[model samples]
Target: MNDALLALTPTLELPSVAREQALKKQTNISDYDFLLGWLYPEDELLPPNLALFSKTTGPVFIDFLGGKKNHRRQFGGGKGQPLARAVGIASDFTPKVIDATAGMGGDAFVFATLGCEVLMIERSPIVAALLQDALNRAHLELQLEAEGKTYRFDDDEHSFLTATISRMQLVNADAADYLNHTKPEADAIYLDPMYPEKKKKAATNKEMTALQGLVGPDIDSSKLLEAAMTVAKKRVAVKRPAKAEPIQLESGKKPSASIQSPNTRYDLYVVASTQS
Candidate 1:
């Protein structure tokens, strides 16, 4: 957990099912300082959400059902988005993607919304738990909608969100280790290893600030990139700050191509062959 001050708080008076699941997650995390607790909504209709109660950053949780994520899922440029293009998404093809450093799952959800099957790998157990909780809640909402019950979104939007959520899968593991052991099946590998915080830019969002504090930087990103290149069947996409230099591989190799957006760049390494 990168030596972050984190701990599981006592489960609140949640619905029976949600309480059980929260307890399981609490048991899974071995070390932490403060608390892992639920933030109950004032609206009785809204469900209680699992959150990491950080003294420095307040509560941090992943919410795919609403908020910025849902808004992006609805309006974020479809396949035309830079992230989609970087992963080789086209009208004729939608690549299965493995997100090697799936911090907070923002990018993974975007890929899923674009109709790509996305495997999100997060090394931090705390982040992984939050992601899993969000996925579970999203799936439950989808199931309720299918049963002709109350849903958070309208019918059309419900259908779209359901499909998007269904396409995403999460795993808590070291990216390099997972990629090295798994078969080279995914068409693209996406790496968004954390970069050092820039001094000149405005402070990052609380979610990102908390994440950086917990996971720290990916010092071994170059090695992870190498492993991803070996495992990815078609290409490996490394997301970098627009002005930042590309990751330096131990093999002295460089990205085959680069795709740029206003604030970010995707360094593409087209895979030539797979290692045995």
Candidate 2:
């Protein structure tokens, strides 16, 4: 592993349950020798038993069952949001989405809640571990909700939450490799590669900052776009900063259309064969 990636996990300690889950995931933490183990106090406010803490950059973890994810699902726009528009969601047609870069699983969660079957691929083992933990917990919570055990949400929210879990599948792999070798059929492929921030100081979000620190920029996003174009049956959606230019594929073609919001722009590459 590179020194920068190693720096992302200065301390990688797992709680007992997280260790058990890691074993089931076939991921051995011992292989990452550079990560030291630092025990947290039992009363610490962390939700997931495991977390990746960087002294310089705060800890990062996933919590789909509660906290930010729950809040977003409850109040966030369902199918009317810009991302939904970018992916081409409609009242009569809900396209299957392959979220090639499933960072933290936010977009996938939204798509799933909107009745789209979403296949999420996360390449980083560390990020995948966090996502898997959240997915497992979310599934359990959905089961409880189905049995009328949890009352934190109403019937509509509960139903959508259940659908999100049932429709989502997380896979740990590179998006390019998955699209190339697996040939998994999907109506659309969504790419949210980390583009260069327009303003260095304007990027204040902790999660995104830590993510960029770990993964760096997606320098080969154009190549990924090429792979996505070949695989997507309907279209490919690339999320970009508002000012960034649309991705240019190997054929020197840009997105056919683009939808813009205040903070981001979604560039859509509609396949000629699958246009509606």
Candidate 3:
């Protein structure tokens, strides 16, 4: 580990070469020493318990993974369900989705679980690296945890769907660049840029702050919306504080329906309707 990276945790003393391996495998300095996580709670690093969530009891960890994945989500009120249900691209056909703003891979995974081949483009190298690490480590068993993540989200027993979803890929790139330049085939484009907390008392997720440090501002969020609207066949779904107005608020497009959750709201822009 670089001395600077080690400064974060003394136990994370991987050499450059070994650190590269750990990053590739999604292992962190903390993985080498779970105690780092305990000591540096302010660093926003999760406990080793998160290292291999596939082994946890039933859906508790899995569901927690989903919530952590969706930083905008809270514990109760089923907020994630409705947001995941949102599909607003103007598409003549249904196919894969492009999560342009894959903040922490939560929305991207949601789009994937919805059966869309999600091509996630994350702007921040560090965030992208972290996400890749999580997905990569999830696919393998580790000493600190059990049952690698598999990346196969499906639950079919008789079929390979449980493992087939490993096909999803994460890319390190700015969302605006991909949308404006690439002519990739996609049915829907999703954007969930971080917004101001709904209320002053609102609690911001630490993981979110960690991501923000890596990924500066969505400086061109408006342009992202424009490109997504132009490309997506169905519609563009933007996650916002339930109380906050739409990101592209002035645009004539209003959300088809707003799903209310205890913490956040799903602002859905319907380019067109889908089977759901």
TM-scores across all candidates? 0.85, 0.80, 0.60
**Candidate 1: how many backbone clashes?**
4
- The sequence of per-residue lDDT tens digits that candidate 2 reaches over residues 4-41 is 32443542332222323333434454454212222332
lDDT, candidate 1, 129-189, per-residue tens: 7888789878876787678666567888888888889999999899898888876479999
CA lDDT of every candidate: 0.79, 0.74, 0.52
Better structure of 2 and 3 per TM-score = 2
Stretches of candidate 3 above 4 Å error? 2-80, 88-95, 141-165, 196-199, 249-257, 272-276
In the range 30-71, model 3's lDDT, one tens digit per residue, is 343111111111223232222111111111112213345434
Best model number under lDDT: 1
For candidate 2, give the lDDT: 0.74
Number of the candidate with higher lDDT, 1 or 2:
1
- TM-score of model 3 (CA atoms): 0.60
Ranking by lDDT: 1, 2, 3
Candidate 1: C-alpha lDDT? 0.79
Each model's RMSD to truth, in Å?
6.6, 7.1, 9.7
Stretches off by above 4 angstroms in model 2 are: 1-47, 144-151, 154-156, 197-199
Worst 10 residues of 1 by lDDT: 8-17
RMSD of 2: 7.1
